[model samples]
Target: MKARSKRLMLVGGGVALLVAAVALVLSAFQQNLVFFHTPSEVAEGKAPTGKTFRVGGMVEDGSIKREADGLTVSFVITDTAKVIPVSYRGTLPDLFKEGKGAVVQGKLEADGTFRASEVLAKHDENYMPPEAAHAVEQASKAAATVSQ
Candidate 1:
């Protein structure tokens, strides 16, 4: 084969290999990626079964139930339009409370309940754990101040 033709063939092969590598890496990353959805969105068939995803919403009031074992807790998360039953088998964040926003990551069970492996309660802007309670307290003070 001519030298020029051989050089062109080598360059084309290099480009093809690079493209294949990128594609493989992207596929692996996509498989690990998880997305957040609201209770309403999940209820509308936005959450695919057996796939990992996150659901964020307010913890519905009077919906929390602790199992006899005390290690598992069940609650209903609501986004005003819909509610999703969630079960978690671990200690929850101290900020997790009723009528507060929270985000849970896990897969939806066949029984239509979300099996959350992790739960995160929303804090204030640029805040950390237990900030949700502080925020509520602050808001209560602000409201009282405004009424005074």
Candidate 2:
């Protein structure tokens, strides 16, 4: 009714609308966000089911298997504490090899294998993606704690 009251109401409405817009944007962004999971997390069932995500870790030594077709390859990824099976049906990166770090983007299947759509392997023996490195560090810490 009063001019001052009208001005206050309008400001409050504007602020509320702004807050709502921000919340909506954040929610939409969250839906599209794909998080990187280590083999430990995947083994613990923390990976998203049916939705695409990233899994990064070292390719377990002696775990690489290639189909007769040559294009389909399966390997086990390990973060020391656990291992996740991944299958990719494409030419792997030149750097992809056993005991090397790799990051695969794809969906986790109901049977516990990650169906990779893309694979990025470390170019050097000392190199790893930052997220994969952090995950390995965390896994090592957890393994140490458990052993203690």
Candidate 3:
């Protein structure tokens, strides 16, 4: 083959390889990425069942129950309009408590409960995830408007 033609072929192959590598990297990133959803979103069927995701909401008052085994803990998460029951087995964060915001990452069990692999409690009394707080505000406003 001519030297010029060989050079062109090499350049084309390099470009193709670069494109393939980029595509592979993007695919892997997408597969590993987890998104945050609200408990109401899960109850409304916006979250994918059986797929792992982070759920942000307030821990419902009086909803936490520790099992007899001492390791299992169950609680309800609420975004005002909906609620999702979550079960977890592990030590909880120091800030975890009823009426406080939390984010739990896990998959939905077949029985409709969330099997949380990890839980994140809000940092302070006033701290809330921006998205979850917005959702709660919207829900309250919607309710107030409807009552009129």
Candidate 4:
């Protein structure tokens, strides 16, 4: 082959390998990606089942339950339009409380319960994840629409 042809082949092969490497990295990142969903989304069947994800909302008033195992805690998470029961087997954050915004990372069970592996409460009265804030805004709008 001509020297020019050989150089072109080498350049083309290098570019192809770079592209393949990038694609592989992106695919791996996508596989491990977890998304945030509100209780309303889960109720509407938009949340992923079987795979672990996140759900953020306010803890339902009077829904916190302490299991016999003390470490196991269950509570209902709600975005006003819908609710999902969640169970966690660990300590809750100091800021975690009923009727406050919180985020839980876990998987949704077939029985409609959330099996949380981690629980994160809002840092303060004013701070919440943007997604959680949006969910709360949507919930209030839904409540208003229902009452109207």
Candidate 1: which stretches are off by over 4 Å?
A: 125-148
Sort by TM-score, best first. 3, 4, 2, 1
Every candidate's lDDT: 0.81, 0.92, 0.89, 0.93
How many angstroms is residue 41 displaced in model 2 relative to the true structure, after the best TM-score fit? 1.3
Worst 10 residues of 1 by lDDT: 127-136
Model 1 TM-score relative to the real fold? 0.73
Instruction: Please provide, for model 3 over 1-148, each residue's C-alpha lDDT reduced to its tens digit, 9 standing for 90 to 100.
Output: 9999999999999999999999999999988889888776787788988998988888999999999998899999888877899999999999999999888999998788999999999888789988778777776776678789
Lowest summed lDDT over 10 consecutive residues: which window, candidate 3? 134-143
lDDT by residue (tens digit), candidate 4, 40-146: 99999999899989999889999999989889999999988889999999999999999999999999999999999999999977898788889989988998999
Per-residue lDDT value at 20 in model 2: 100
- Residue 38's lDDT within candidate 1 is 66
C-alpha lDDT of residue 146 in model 4: 92
**Per-residue accuracy of model 1 over 1-148 as CA lDDT, tens digit each:** 9999999999999999999999999999999899877676687787889999988766889999999998899999776556899999999988888887788899999899999999998665444334333333444565577679
Q: Per-residue lDDT for 53 in model 2?
A: 93
Candidate 2 ranges with C-alpha deviation above 4 Å: 1-32
Our tally of clashes for model 4 stands at 0
